[model samples]
Target: MGPSRLHLAQGALAALALGAAVLLQGQAPAASASSDNLTADRVENLRLGGDGVAQRRHMWTIFADMVSDEEPDFVHWQGESGVFGAEAAKRPSGIQGFQRPKSIGGDPHLIGAPIIAYNLFNPAAFAHIRAQGLYRKATLDRLQLTGGTGSVPPFPAAAIVIKTAWWPVAPEGLTAMPVWDPELNPPDPTGNPYLGWARVVAVDPTNISQGKTAAVQFVGRSFPGARRVQLEAFHHVAVDAAMAKQLAGDPESNRTAIIALGRPIAVNDQLALVGINVMTHEQQDWVWGAFWWHDRPEVGPFAADRPSTLPGPWRNYLMQAAFDAKTPRASDAGAHICFNPWLEARFPDGGQGGGTVSNCLSCHQRASYPAAPFLPVTRGAPNLREDPALAPDRLRTSFLWSLTLHAQRD
Candidate 1:
């Protein structure tokens, strides 16, 4: 698991490149899967076995448990409250209310739809941070060793963290349920797969105009009455107009798109959950999984072990997982690639010019107090044993970037 050179077959590399290309085009590839869907009893299995498919299925079980409505929505659990505004802090009842995503960062904005995001911590994660007083930058800096590689203790086995991306239906005031237009997305201009394959969604012009709703409209191909079906089912939260305006403020271009979509905004406007990144420290290296909304949820390796118990909108998401830096022994040994198209597709490697393949466990492994750059220093497969992004001088953050990036000064 430590830094070691990995030699992958040319064919496997090509497959990953092809997969990435298909995603950029905004079209999901056809499925070729085995019968690995999970059941209620299987949800308890957390071991990342040697088999890649089984490991991914194990991750799918974790995803199902996280999104289960039997418990409070992840948004209501607890946020990385040490950040600015403290708007995401938990309520007296222990339910952390929703907060507007501060920035789009490197995430991609979908056609006709601009993206927004927020992060939350499970009880175990939040408690560990609070108990250790790790929310303060000073605490992290002080923990850095005067000598030796300053690796901090890892979080407990039960700790979990989530970063969710959303589609903000705009106009600040428009709460009308919107429809999904299959044709509205721009066609893949570059027919060659390398440039990207499917058509990206089209931007809705009427929704972007400042304060004007002369004719609220969706610009792409029409999907009659399919309003909330494809993406409508995911859990959503209300965002007031004031906050919506603030989130849409920076990128003048996104300002409009953020306000136009259907759902909620401004007390009434609701944003749909488009994709999410889930990290569970169930194992030492930590098991990583990402889920993105897909019109066709029954295809691909990510869709392999989806359980029927995953209610409504949760079933619409397609997931991929990584239990190690290199592929599991059961699969062709290659750089494991798992990322949410909605979350990491736009950027090269999770961010900047990093690696050819994106690995969530690998990326988060670099989370350190002196804070390593979001982009991994190593190219291709990152060494899980000895991370280049994490130096001995810095304190590791147990793979939680929210702790490293969002923790504020006291």
Candidate 2:
């Protein structure tokens, strides 16, 4: 079947199951009603407050600033010599830590070819998890179970999770290329060496609560919006260009160059704001921010080419959405969001299969602390579709992935 038809079919099944569950529990039908009745303005206001537009603009500015700062507090290096200072020796000690050991080889198959990731959790978010009385080790262990409750509390509004990749930036005067090792199974690094991308996931309880349907509400204490944002920097390219022009540049000197180019350039500027992703409510498809060049007819000279090595469906999806306007109404001053047709088409109705078919929210909804060590779900795991069998019976982690890390001994 075509993508739209498939999505409709999957949504129908989910809606039926959701409706039946609500009816069986004797809940009011109004609880399951769609947010469609609410005007766009009302929905935006409810989620973002009276100054919603200003708040969104402020957020975008903050994110832009964060991405540009060369010495940002949130940036951490993975492995033994990370920015955590002496604390690096202590694994899983701080709120901001690396996910993999420094020595781990990069995943050759992944795009953006990241060698390692430095994950940063805002102080409030870190403290909130600690307040739950669950330590990192216990929390990580608990998350492995297929069922049962955990001591972790839901992430509060404005909680931010930032992950920065360690990829080599492409030097100036060269086409962005992938660095690969033939011996490696994955072949390429985790992120693009020439240009690294940082991804952010922020918790917005106001937006989330306003958009939740009965099915989402029935789960208890879960919020509606979990905004995701991504930023890209051409550290290598910018630095390379600066060095060639000036004749006296090194990695340390190039730091300033990278920061200078962090903002949007007229055309072919090294650094750029990629786009943002937002999900204000459970009933709606996650809003995606297409890159600026997406609206242009030509694939602008600065646009990165899809790596031929990528899987077919993923490549095709990227190509289609490159210049398409999926949600024209979601202007920056309004909802400040857009849809990613490629993502929707690939994932369909969010009923997961494997590979790129994974839905962001659906997959994350399964993020709760397991009671014991069970098989961790792979990237392409089938969607649980909010199946009760797959959901926890009590308190959940509410989609926070960092809570699953094991604490290290001093």
Candidate 3:
């Protein structure tokens, strides 16, 4: 598929921003979830009327509530071990546990390092798998080839999937850096890290269907083939600034570093809301949402007219949808959250480049199972449409590649 007209439209917007002499500066004031732009009333109205912005705002509200302990709660903490509190599946243990490689860095089988995921299906939608024992490889293979409603059954509205990472914890205000040891399939128990936060991607069928028309008009993109809309949210548990500083200074090394800097101070606090990524069928790319906490003085504010910058402390907490792929520039993009610049910096060619320009949708658009042989280490975007290996016939694992683990043999 050639670049859609939407791409061209985004380019035009970028041109306009570049040509302007007096660019907007400072940051837009933060808006409360109940504000006019993101009011609960507006969300309900948009849900009923089928507005894309409403869908984005509504999802943002839900995520905000999760982090802020707000009203109309839709998410809750389920703890570190196991899936939703159930003992983690032991059969698919070892390298076959979850297929997707670590989102940040390290080997696919390593623990402590961040891991990619697509397995989180809401109870209603996941019931299909449970009822039919689809978690089994044999059953999952059959379902992938000839099951579900559409090419992929729309995750029941509100169904959520997550990508999570753990931070090293220590008592004497010091801890060894977590390393990837392939030989240690599940990693030594003591070497394992604790949960830092989870990045949530959820399906909202109603909003997706409604957003189709609105996206084309507002964002210059359209997803006519979309059966369900998806939104992304982030949850973070703060760490000590001293630990963060140590980790930030030498994320690659520094397995053992101490007494080099300041006192230990808390960084992230509790399981708080970070940001949200909203999508419209019109723009295959999604919109990013972030909180003031991620904002920086140099980067202006989160989602401000000016391009945002990633400084100390907030460097690791990167948000997707930070820039509009159409414009492909930080100044033109909206305020969004994504992976920390440090993490993206580790993999320059990887989807998360260490720059003002990044798009969660664009990066994830390449998500696939039985990924091309050159995947994992291959930086840059994969040619899904042109590459025969990625052809739909060869098993396009929808957007969640981790789900492939269900059918993967140990």
Backbone N/Cα/C clashes per model:
22, 25, 17
Q: How well does candidate 1 match the true structure, expressed as C-alpha RMSD?
A: 12.2
- Tens digits of lDDT, candidate 3, 1-410: 12323444667442233223112211223333344234334333543454433333333333332333232122331111113212233223211132232232223323233322113333332443345443344544565577643233333332333433332222232121222212232322223221211111122322433442221210122323332211211233334454344334442223211211122323441122222232322121223333222322234232333212222333323233322323222333442323322222122223332222334443444444444432222223455677554566544444443444433332
Output the TM-score of candidate 1.
Answer: 0.66
* Candidate 1 C-alpha lDDT tens digits along 324-405: 7656532334556666665554434223232224567656777777655575323245555566555556678777776676
> Once model 1 is optimally superposed onto the true structure by TM-score, how far is the C-alpha of residue 158 displaced, in angstroms?
1.0
Model 1 segments more than 4 A misplaced: 1-48, 70-72, 82-96, 100-114, 146-149, 170-197, 200-231, 241-265, 329-333, 349-356, 376-388
What tens-digit string does per-residue lDDT give for candidate 2 at 1-410? 24334545677543233334323323323222242343233434433343333333322323333333344334332322222222423443222232232222222213221122234555544545555533344444545443234435444443444433332222232112221111221212222122221111221212322332211111122223322111122221222343233212223213323422222122222232122223222112211122221222124321233322222112211121111111112222221222222122112122212212223433444444442221221232333564442454533445433333323212
Off by over 4 Å in 2: 1-62, 65-73, 76-116, 130-135, 139-151, 170-175, 178-358, 371-389, 405-410
Best by lDDT: 1
Q: TM-scores across all candidates?
A: 0.66, 0.37, 0.43
User: lDDT at 86 for candidate 2?
Assistant: 28
Deviation in Å, model 3, residue 241 alpha carbon: 24
Model 1 has an lDDT value of 0.52
lDDT value for candidate 3?
A: 0.31
